[model samples]
Target: MSTNTLAPVLTPERLATAYSYSSYRQLIDELQAQGKTTGLQQSAALTHYTHLNVQRMQRLDKTTQVVPELREAVQNLQQSYMWLVLTEGWCGDAAQIVPVLEAIAQASNGRFTTRYFLRDENLDLMDRYLTNGSRSIPKLVVLRVDTLQEVAQWGPRPAEAQALFLSLKSSGATHEEYAEKVHAWYARNKTQATQQELLTLVRDLA
Candidate 1:
């Protein structure tokens, strides 16, 4: 099994004490208002931001960022699946992916909701959902809200993101070059331009 080597102390006590449910809701609302059916590129940026929220990271720097494509997809979205985002501060998988998913959810209205599962604190939830008998972090499980159907899952990967790394290996690339390729691939793959596309994709899976 892979492991996290960052070893940055999470200051769990501080994090737990400072947790604010209302603040999280407000952030979602804020992002939603800013995101409407604009274009795929903008949708991509917003989705990236949403994934960051789930990872509990600070927002990206705007000067280096592109304008997000917002669409009015939220109004017509139908909730089909409930998503469980299991994460930790030091886990790279959570860092890169979860926030984008959260952004997509906000764009889709309330079609999606996420609960943060801090593995250090929520071991029971981790055991029920993730834990393949080890103590790693960052597991995302998809469940259909109405029928409780499990849709898909992926995670506990490292900064190099194994799946992404492999996908970038077809050419003679340096490590830095590979990293750029992986980031570009991930960014493009996550964004959904229209409500119809989002609905069709999620519906196919659910």
Candidate 2:
């Protein structure tokens, strides 16, 4: 059977239940206190990642400077869009990207708004936008708010980060080694790649 057939249809009703960026962060903070992680799987490693993710998010939330080009592109948008993102607190990629997304949306005035969905809770939606058949978090689905139809999508990681991840995985690097390198790349790039890519996406919509 085709993989597409396995995914659930995304309805507006379903989308409405997703969390706001603020609420999603709050959920993570709340979960952290309980020593829990999102999704069905629970482990010390995952929980540790979740805690690290929160710190990453907090740092990014404080420091992510939205490029003027992206802000202008979003502000010029004639149509409003729903920036639906699939993610998890333990996802390092999501940790680095989602806050930048939120900052962009905030700069949009009201034309771009972000909604956060936990990947484990929204597997059906995540199935629709897999990367190499892997259910990668931080998948963005840009939807026209008026019609609720998808216009563009992006995710999992920026191109450079994806490349680094692939190289590490193929080279038999330990998971810790792989994660460290990828995150260090993010630290150096400092959201520039992500913002530039999203700027292109936003411009096309205008």
Candidate 3:
């Protein structure tokens, strides 16, 4: 799997220019207004997934519960950073994870801000953060707000969830089967795993 070598050259100014999540939502709204759907491309599956993710994000936004540990970790953050995320509206993992990330940022009390980029539209940026040579959606690139230097990164999914997904894939489970199981894991985990992992990352940087 290839990893990004050029990431170090990226600066805060460049990152700051990336589209915000609100902008991405505006784009989605425009598409819907045009009687078209989907974030980056036009396809029935993409449209369906896009709408599904919209609803998922809304529901999670209202319902995600942050544990005490995560709240404290974010509260104690001594420096500012940006969670520049590459995702698409059709990405299931993004639907599950992005809201939780937004919650974390919100709890950070302005120490952390998140920006969203459509993975397909930002191929160069996404390529720099690819997972195992694959352009994985919902890739969170954590960068220092002062210097834009990478502090840490997370995503695709939490480790435990990724493990379950890999297990199902290796067993030759169909896409539907694996997807159902992976989402069920998210439903059960309820952002705890993601929060804990992100807390560890933030603590290390602190």
Structural similarity to truth (TM-score) of each candidate: 0.45, 0.94, 0.89
Alpha-carbon RMSD, each predicted model: 12.7, 3.4, 2.9
- In candidate 2, position 88 carries an lDDT of 91
- What is the Å distance of residue 130 in model 3 from its true position? 1.8
Provide the overall lDDT of each model, using Cα atoms, as 2-decimal numbers: 0.47, 0.87, 0.79
Best by TM-score, which number?
A: 2
Winner of 2 and 3 under lDDT: 2
| Local accuracy of candidate 3 as per-residue lDDT tens digits, 83-126 | 88888777889989988888888888898898887788778888
Which ranges of candidate 3 are over 4 A from the true structure? 1-13, 33-40
What is the C-alpha lDDT profile of model 1 across 56-170, one tens digit per residue? 3343211112113332443344554455566544344454555555655655567665555556566665675554576545565555555444565445543334556656665
Backbone clashes, each candidate: 17, 0, 0
Q: Clashing residue pairs, candidate 3?
A: none
Write the residue-wise lDDT of candidate 2 on 9-34 in tens digits: 36778878999998999988998899
Candidates arranged by lDDT, highest first: 2, 3, 1
Global Cα lDDT for candidate 1:
0.47
